[model samples]
Target: MVSSRERIKAFDKKLLKSGEYSVILSRLPAYIFELLLIVIATSGDKLSEMDVFIVMYAWGLTFYIAPYLNIWENRKNVSIYEVLKSLPVNQWDIFKVRVEYIAKLLLSRFLIMLGLQIPGFMMTGKILKENMINSLAAIGWAALVLTIYALPGISNYRSNKQIKWKAKQGGIMWKKM
Candidate 1:
């Protein structure tokens, strides 16, 4: 059996070659804004409660907006799911790979945010408890938002037999006359 890591690497390569990474550019503003918020929250001698709240809100907003931005960006193109389906891999593996890809993407961002805190500590000579808590909360909220966004796709892949059945039937629908 092929390893999940190998599958993910293959998918990543394909996505990269197809210029799918460009879609991330659409989210550049959110990323920059989040980073700015982090800098603001961490650079001070004392943590501001208001700054922490703004950082939390910014994280939540960024996470919440990501799914919609992805959908909109890919609306005119073949989706990652469809690309995975076209591959020779099993349906279950396809689902796993997609979820793993998303997880890795989110994880990298989380790590970057955490790493950004280090500079703030160096500059300020102290780590703020509130900032740490804010980081944890942001990641928790991101995971929740991503999971909620992923549910519909997860449901579609949960039953391969159902999908096959619908595909075979051409998924016909009746419209009101």
Candidate 2:
């Protein structure tokens, strides 16, 4: 039987292999489009706090669709969950590893988007303090909304050993890996 730690590592790798990289790469076009929108939106003028907020918000919202897209792209394929479910590991172990995979992906997206937004922020002609605060605030709100959206799944983990694969409301939609 594989150790839980090893199983967790395998699950993470499965997730990375399945479609995360491709999903992230596919987002490049969307990012470029949003950048163009921001440039056009603020053409010939310095950006207001609202403009900064809109850009940061769009940036945050763009990457937010990545994980879901990854999941959807691999929906017909056999998931790591399907593979691990018959193994010796406990169900919670599988569920926790899945959550970890999601959290890691979200964190990476947040960092990547934030880093990519710095240039846009600088272009706004705003003071560094204002840009930093607004960027942080916008990212923070996006993070909060993402967390709230995940809360139902997290709470479901408390009552159920295995993550739900059903599409019904209140059911966890994330497939393994």
Candidate 3:
């Protein structure tokens, strides 16, 4: 029997081949902008409250909007969930792989942002508390937004139903079965 890790790896490889990974490429600009925000938030000795607020707001907005854009662009194509459903893989394994992938991406960015603050702290002997707080808030906002967007579909999948999108009268309709 294939180990769970091996099964997830196989499913991930198939997902990659199915062009599901292209969503990352499509959101590259947003990712770069997010990185720049992290650098700006962490590089300074003293970040103004306004500066931190603006940066965090932009970061959160990017996190919220990028997923919508990706979904809109791919609305006509079969979704990764649909493709996975057609496979012989277990549903729980699919959920694990997806959640793990998202967690890794988010955690890596958060770690990089935290790491970037180290040099300034080392030189100044002071932590930029406001910037750090804002950064934490931004990441928390991102996780919340993603969770809100993901939970319904995940629950539906767990319940052995799928959401199908169909066009009717030039608009989209969601049919869950």
Candidate 4:
């Protein structure tokens, strides 16, 4: 049988070539066009480069995560019973594939931000600009891995703490990572 990892790589390669992906990628062009318009519209006036970075960050945040969030939201409409009836290998395979896609999207966004930051830094220089990009780069790789691994248990970790607190009339225990 073909492995789930292979399936996901194939799917991503397909998606990268698809028109929908083209549309998604075109968002950057639209963003750049809008920024040009902003500059043109304010041609007589002075503006902060900070303002441009702020707008770019806000817009890119939406575009960066929209596709993954859409996938998660669609899962809400799926029938749990129907899914449960699927074969174990298929289920495991598909689950892994979805995780891979989500992971890839996250990594892609991180790299895109890092890629964009260099140009912005060139434009803004270190003295006037806040150093978010440099700071983000310092931690981005490790944070990405932790964020993915943290997803499986982060909420429950909080919930478990609450549960322990509520039951502390008997006793309490703590485990360190």
Winning model by TM-score: 3
**Candidate 4 error regions (>4 Å):** 4-76, 79-84, 88-90, 127-177
Model 3's number of clashes is: 0
- CA RMSD for every model? 7.9, 7.9, 5.9, 11.8
The model with the greater TM-score, 1 or 2, is 1
Q: By descending lDDT, how would the candidates be arranged?
A: 3, 1, 2, 4
Candidate 3 local lDDT, 46-66, one digit each (tens): 444555555554445444333
lDDT of 2 by residue, 1-177 (tens): 768867667755666567766666756754664565355333322224465655555445534443432243322323333445567767566555544545565466445545544665567654545544554554455555445433434333422333343434445475443
What is the lDDT for 121 in model 3? Answer: 70
* Candidate 3 to native Cα RMSD, angstroms: 5.9
Writing each residue's lDDT as its tens digit, candidate 1 over 16-75 gives 546555646656766666666567555643434555655554455444334322332312
**lDDT of each model, Cα atoms only?**
0.53, 0.49, 0.54, 0.42
TM-score of 2: 0.43
Encode model 4's per-residue lDDT on 1-177: one tens digit a residue.
877568545654554455465447645643664455344323322223345544444344433423322221111212221223343435445445545554665465445544555555566454313344432432344335434432424323443454455446545443321
How do all models score by TM-score?
Answer: 0.54, 0.43, 0.58, 0.36
TM-score of 3: 0.58
Candidate that would win on lDDT: 3
